[model samples]
Target: MLRFLNCRCLLLAGLLLLAPTVQAARTILIFGDSLSAGYGIRQDAAWPALLAKRLHEKSLDYNVVNASISGETTSGGRARIDAALSRYSPQVVVLALGANDGLRGLPLAQLRDNLTAIVASAQSRKARVLLVGQRVPPNYGAYAIGFHDVFGAVARARKAALVDFLLDGVATQPKLFQADNLHPTAEAQPLLLDNVWRGLAPLLE
Candidate 1:
């Protein structure tokens, strides 16, 4: 009886050990820019880091990879996407680029094309994409409007989920913005995570 009971306990332990491995966790990749990179903040204080914490709180099994680089443009994102995709093999990719392109006055057409290619590449790898939009400073004039439209257009064309503006809540709010008035303050990280979670939670389900 003792031997039989020991065997049963071992079997239960084996099952327990296999449970988490049997179900692979989903991975979400944030392919973005300075805003997403936590520019002046500690790495753990970034929105992506907060997002991972949020996921944990909700008991979701996911790996959030922040591949954001400060000053990265749509073209830069497109160039490095293949490597990111290969390394992360994410189930979802948050495409949040193009702001730098607009800042530099790069042709909107080129920006559009770069984003389109990035989306297509992710899709080809069977990854669902969430396009995160941005608004250029008003000084860019009509170009700012055009820049803002690019994300929606691409999302519509590709049938991807669109987060109209990644900085929706903090953009105009002085307290939420950092000294440079570009990136959000660390205190606003949760709200930023909330914005992303609203669009991302459904995809996980």
Candidate 2:
């Protein structure tokens, strides 16, 4: 009888230990730019928020933290990453940066290095990374192509999933962009979430 009681107690303790692991929410950190920050729109209308809503709609156990700042560059992201990582303790980090750097015609090598370091830093914390690429405006000329390639190259090197062109469906589409032609309009938020979700959902499972 004592042996039976001991076995039941051990089984209960094992189930208790597994309960928290099964119910814990997965955390995703969106470390991005003005686009993700909802530059001119309300914060709740941003892509990150929309993504969170979508996750809820699907009944997924997850939470999203938006760490986007308008006009953020790779350098700026790298500088602030430690704090962001520390605060969020994310299981996954969505790295969407370098658009401002490309706009400023920053060197591609510098962008590559910054991005590589950022990915490595996140990996060191055992967090999975998803890199979101951005294309520079055509006015930047040949340098723009090179700048854009930095994202794919870094992602390939780091073995991180890449979301080619975060603004794929909205960029250069006047109807989807704000008056300045730099930010996505609220109407475009859903598509942006779709773009991110395509790359993010697979890794989540």
Candidate 3:
């Protein structure tokens, strides 16, 4: 009986030792706009989901919680950031907003401040941030330059990682985008994931 009791205790100890590893999947919260939300594609086909798949392929213990909305703006993301950080307590926060603000011709100053706040909020929670930049059509005029510059400025000032531009190569290719020519299509998801992973992979380590 004593031998059986010892065996049971050993089993319990082993299980207890493994519990934290099982429950401690590091989370990466992707807070963005339609681009990350899958817009015209299936949710599972989105770059965020692809990121999860890549993580599993490499045996990384991480979870990606995509909190993106189709029309979300920098201000909107800033407003909800604290609640998201509190809820997920993510190890990394991917800030991919501000596109809507640019599209709507919102004030660039407001966009910059909102992004700064979002980055600060995530960092305050001990979460590493990746700020994904956006670019507007040339028709929007010189305002586009300032809009594009905000991501780098915020990243540098706040000491955050940056993807530079989420749509980089894909943006110039008309075939890669949806009919609206704004959001990326399923075919472009992999490239988008690659662009983000270039910056995000380091944070995971």
Candidate 4:
């Protein structure tokens, strides 16, 4: 009986010692703008939230941190990147900005510079990156084309993952958007998750 009790105590101690390792899941930071921040939709209905559920369903050990802010531009993201990096220390960073920059018709060079800086910062920390792309209306003509290409240019130069456009399918459909015609409705969140997953999945391993 004494021997059995000692064995049981040792087993319990072993589990206690291993508990933190089992729970210390790596972090995935969704660093983006209004789209990722769930603008005009319930926080739970956002794609980032769905990502957490999907990770759990797949039994992937990762904790997600949605550190996005609505109206975030590449410049704004650059300003905050260091603080965010120091705070989360994420293993993966879903870098989604420049939409607001495109919308505002900011200089394409400005967009490219800020994006390069943001990706470089994350890479410096050894964090994998999924750089989400954005585009302005065709009415902007050459400027819009330049804006769209900047995301890819930065991604290639930095060797980060790229999602060509976050709202690729949803953007074409009027019904998928909110009243403001900028944000996607709650129903479109899953589709957004699907698009992001393509780029994100590759970096998970």
Candidate 5:
């Protein structure tokens, strides 16, 4: 009987010792567009999933919640920001939108305003924000430049972490993109995650 009691106590103590690690797991909310939604590839092959795997490998204890959708714009993300924030209560909110807006030639000012609102909302909730920048082809000229500039402007004003361009290494490689030429191929997911990790790692710490 004494042996049984000692064994139970040891088990309880062990569990207690392990409890903090389990409870310390925080969430990272990835809010973005098609690039992050894993557009033409399997969901597990997307950067968000890759990020989760990397975090686990590094023993970071972060839960990555990817709330991305194909063709989503900044206004669309703004509309849903509140609900997402309330639902996830994330420790870090990765704001990666505005690509579709630039592609569609939406007003750069509108894009900036919407993105600013999203960042402000996330920050208000005490979630750290990582603003992922994007760029359009030079053909759009001034519109493209203005659109690309929004990411940095918003990040600077809000004091969020900035990933200057999500497609840094992949953009130059045609094979890294899907046939549509906009979304990334499965092979490019890790590269995308790497770009994001450079900005996100500091926040995780």
Candidate 6:
């Protein structure tokens, strides 16, 4: 009986020591569209998955929750933002929507408003936001330029950090992209992770 009690005491002590480390792990919410959803490749090859791996390798206390979906637009993200916040209760939110919005030539005003609302909602929940920007083809003309600029504008106005482009290094490399030329191949995932890391690192601190 005495030996049993002593074993129980040691187990309790070990659990007490581990309490803080367990509580230290927080959520990082990845909110985006197909670009982030690993559209043409394996899910594990996605940037968000790479982010989780990076966090683990660095021994950071964050877990990544990718709530991204294929064909998701800013309007869709806006409608679901609150639910995502409630579900993840994240410490940091990586906002990467608007690509589909640009592709569809959605009104910039609506895009701006939706993004603003999403950022505001996350901030209100005390989550730091890293807004990831997108760029469309030059063929889209002035609308493409406007779409690209809106992300930076929102980040500035909302006081959020910005990743100027998710495909910064990969975009210009056609061979790095999948056959569709819109999505990056698995090989390009790391570059995407690197792009997001620049803005996301400071928030982790």
Point out where model 5 deviates above 4 Å: 1-24
Ranking by lDDT: 6, 5, 4, 3, 2, 1
**C-alpha positional error of residue 77 in candidate 3 after TM-score superposition, expressed in Å:** 0.6
lDDT of each: 0.76, 0.76, 0.78, 0.79, 0.79, 0.80
What's the true lDDT of residue 192 in model 1?
76
Clashing pairs in 5: none
Off by over 4 Å in 2: 1-24
lDDT measured at residue 86 in model 2 versus the true structure, 0 to 100: 86
lDDT of 3 by residue, 1-205 (tens): 0000000111110000111235546888889877777776777788888988888788888878888776777887889889988988989998988878887789989999999999999999999999988887777779988888988999999999988888878877878876665567899999999999999999997
Q: What is the lDDT of residue 203 in candidate 1?
A: 82
Instruction: Look at candidate 2 and tell me the lDDT of residue 147.
Output: 84
Q: What TM-score goes with each of the models?
A: 0.86, 0.86, 0.87, 0.88, 0.87, 0.87
Report the C-alpha lDDT of model 4 over 1-205, residue by residue, as the tens digit: 0000000111110000111234546888888777787776777788988998888778788878888776667887899898988987889999988877876778999999999999999999999999998777778789978988999999999999999998878878878877766668899899999999999998997
Q: What's the lDDT for residue 57 in model 5? A: 81
Q: What is the lDDT of residue 55 in candidate 5?
A: 84
Residue 170 in model 1: lDDT: 72
Candidate 2, position 107, lDDT: 88
Which candidate would rank higher by lDDT, 2 or 6?
6
Question: After superposition on all CA atoms, how large is the RMSD of candidate 3?
Answer: 15.2
Give stretches of model 1 more than 4 Å off.
1-24
Query: Lowest summed lDDT over 10 consecutive residues: which window, candidate 6?
Result: 1-10
> What digit string (tens of lDDT, one per residue) describes model 5 on residues 36-119?
877667777888888887887888877878887667788988999999899878899999888878877888889999999999
